[model samples]
Target: MSFSRRAISLCAAVTLSYGVISPAIAQAQDFNGIVDSVHTHAADDASAKMAPLGSYASGQLAESAAEIVAFHAGSKRILTVNALSGEIDVLDASNPQKPTKIGSVSAGADKEINSVTVREDGLAVAAVQQSNKVLQGEALFFDAAADDLGAAELGRVTIGALPDNVHITDDGAYALVANEGEPSNELDAAGTAYVADPAGSVSVITLPAPGTVEAATQADVRTAGFEAFDAPGALHEDIRIFGPVNHHNKPSLDLEPEYVASAKGKAFVTLQENNAIAIIDIASARVEKVVPAHIADHLQVPIDSSNKDDKAELRTIPVKGLSMPDSIHAFTSGGKTYFATANEGDAREWGVEEKDGGSGVYTDEVELADVIDNGQVCEGVLDDVEAEALGDKKVAGNLKLSNVSGWDEEKQCFDELYAYGSRSFSIYDEAGNVVFDSGSDFEEITASLNQPGVFHHNADNEDPDFDDRSDNKGPEPEALTIGHIGERTYAFIGAERVGGIFVYDVTDPANAKYQTYINNRDFTVDFDEDNYDSTKLAGDLGPEGLAFIDKQDSPNGEYLLVVGNEVSGTTTIYEVESVVEKEPSTSGSTKGSSNLSRSSLSSR
Candidate 1:
């Protein structure tokens, strides 16, 4: 089946009794139309309803998808988790453009999984935010791959803290959970999700970390890593929600959720604007440590030592450090598993990675990393390194970091960076260095450097026309995952706003190339070819997450790509064909365009 056709079937559209969750997702059902009132304790009992996909799904394919309104056996589907209205949308994209909303899981703020993921059992788990310091998001586990074909209300398991994300690994030995609590899932729901909330919760998960990895060889793309998105568990945070929400973390619960994940065992997360990536050991249910990474002062690093004049515009970007370690992929190196997040920062931040934090050290005994380039400078960013070997040093009571390092070499540069990178596909090393830094470097290369590469301090900043590496424009991929297309390696990137998927052939990291681009703006049986340019990017598809079912472990060699769009509030599924079965996709995708249309928040 074609990619678009499969994406359309992730969810089927059967009219279940009045339920919760719709585009303008409100507090209760009947949004604008005599909506029903909701009970705070009773979840899975909302009266809201989702709107039909606009004339957008107009092709014959959509008609096919409309028929599948429930989960089916043997079918690999993609599920959408909506944090705002507090619900889940399952799409049976066994057809793409004509994808159908098969089922809807209506719970309360209790079902909001900050992190949503599906596993081989055809099951998906959500970490719903809870209300306490002890617990975070609630864990809502349900059967997705099963095709009983009925309106089933799989009640959720109340996980007390905010379950940021979940992971199901290949070995299946364990499911990893990132419980980013403190304010807890139930703590603050003001900014995220189209809805509002006051608390958070987390779940319990454990995964075996792999062997060790070398710092210098961190950027090598040949290594295969593993990650899992698990379910939220039962439990509540340690704190109550009676007073005004915290204020320090504008978006967070007025608190620095040290780690996006703080579940027992292990956790790793990136703070987009915070300019940091946090790692925690849930063994004791507390943040073990934080890797505060920053960039080098490339601007100050004089390209020519003789040119004494200090260049002004040396660092093109001001927030160079990995803008946000949005999502992380952990792989074992040396003797341990190292988690690396996609640091989507700009050149200025990237350059600072090479500089030594001259004065301000978050801690006095920090192993101040020296910026590779001399004379460069930047503040508030920490040098890269995996979880520092904290032999016996415990910064906080019982909060100790693992000896393993955190990084991604695929996104690294310095002779190791891939030139023919499918821009935006980054790889961070153990020390949080850019082994393959496509996300930020791509911005710099196309804009200031006049090429696709790291943001050079330019030896001198005074020269106005030095180079613009940040000029190139393309899809701004947010979510990433590695998959197999036959025997080849593929990376599925979610371009939420632009509304399409970017497929990359990473069989050879050094020669990582773009393969296919799926158009996701509207039903595409009829689209204006004129509106195909970057600027012509059709708006409002809201693609968020991507997944492909590998029957390789099952009966059929079927592969399905599941997507959760932020705008449509729908999880779309797509069937991916292997290179052997079909040719690799050759189109550039439309990504980064915001899908900020027809959206609302439900306040409980």
Candidate 2:
């Protein structure tokens, strides 16, 4: 995985044929380049198919019992973060269809376990945050295969505040942690702002190689901090640096590290609130550069910007969106590394008196109509046609926009309106340039599906009301991971709200194509947490994390996609198959050819 600059062409292939070709044949031929390029070690007509295999329920609804997940190959076990119980629940996946809870790991009484990962040798690491998240956290290690499962402690190392995510390299040489230093809800003594806001950072720990009896210590921890960006003008103007001023009054405190994806001595961190990606030199433990994420133009990428519209419909609007990516994963394609992100937007609304019992309030979210009524928007910001459309509550008027961005200081008003999350997934090159984006494809594809009772476009995970999350981040692509099957690389993305997985073939980063979309949720169930029946086949809901197991490590000798559903507290295993599509019959009847349903949406 070396970093190299290359020009990626986005031109569509021209079709100039003499014979009359059927649309299906033409479409199949269109994928010839992609199919031919990766089929050196695979079948030429092979494509991916995914379906549910099994599920294990914690019986804890809406409690976030199952969030992050990792697999232990040697032990034949699956580890998931049970945030509600503050523990790691270990399951025996030797029998993939009936994975039962075998044991659990606890980092003492009051610690909150946010993430967990396992090395190839069955060594497990869990990121533990303090009860008060603003305080410093720690990473706990365990022998995952111990008889009592997690009862054998391997080691522990002190980390930064609120360690939200942890990852181990394939070689198991280093462990990376994202310390999301969030602010406390309590107000300061002056009652003007938050009590404390710690500076966010990334902790890189040098771990002992596999089979080593020694453990990582505090001395092995090296922090990648943002102090260098604290200087004025160091951060780009496009990188968001707003919210109630922290006590430290440094830009470092405002830049929270949300997720990390590393490769070849370089780590790419998602600064979700800042709308940027910070590249870190892992060897030097220093910030290299912060690349601002693209702000999507709604006119070109249509969106459903209003929940009040009473239906799910994509429309062109006069607005831009901040692509605040949450989870990112790195993969190599054509000998170059590319990063894929789930552009799940977020809002910084902290210390609300009613919600958190705080004395003060701090938020950057405001309604588009509110900004207009308050005279915070410029007089001629919207054209006559744009004004009429945006003035309707069923359109962009009810959409949520960031008040901290698009401000014209000299004019004392906002010249442009910005929304949260682009509501899609994107592929970025080494330089953080957008190689490809699934612009509005997630919403449109989900809406076109015939899954009437199971899924509703833009609906919340807990409530199946249509268009409920439209005004917010629709579908909210938050979970992401990459896998290789049959010489082709695929990116699996999960929608946090609608609760499903979208698969794409990224063998060619510039020409990624959609493969399939599968969701296990049975929306017909009355989702009442208290009286919910775990035995019912309600399916998994609120997918928070995804892990892809190659066929070599799979228990059933098949590719597997594991999903940890936060809302339903269930961990599901989906068997992925690479099937060869059968050619049409000579009698003109084509049926049951094993060809998976591919999305018809156009690529960006």
lDDT string, candidate 2, 1-604, tens digits: 1111111111211221111111121133222101111000111232675656667888798899999999988888999999999999999999876678999999889889999998888778899999999999999988887896655677789899999999987678888999999888776655566778898999998888887634588999999999999898998889988767444557688788998888877889999998999998887888899989878888777788778866556777768889899999998876797999999989987774754564477788888878876767787777656665675778767888998889997998998889999988889998889988878777766554423453467888887777788888889999999998887788899999977887877777776766667676656665778776532245677899999998999998989988999988888887787654332222311111123222221210
C-alpha TM-score for every candidate: 0.47, 0.87
- The stretch of ten residues in a row with the least summed lDDT in candidate 1 is 1-10
Q: Give me the displacement of residue 314 in model 2, in angstroms.
A: 0.2
Against the true structure, candidate 2 reaches a TM-score of 0.87
Write down the lDDT that model 1 would get.
0.34
Question: What is each predicted model's overall lDDT from 0 to 1?
Answer: 0.34, 0.77
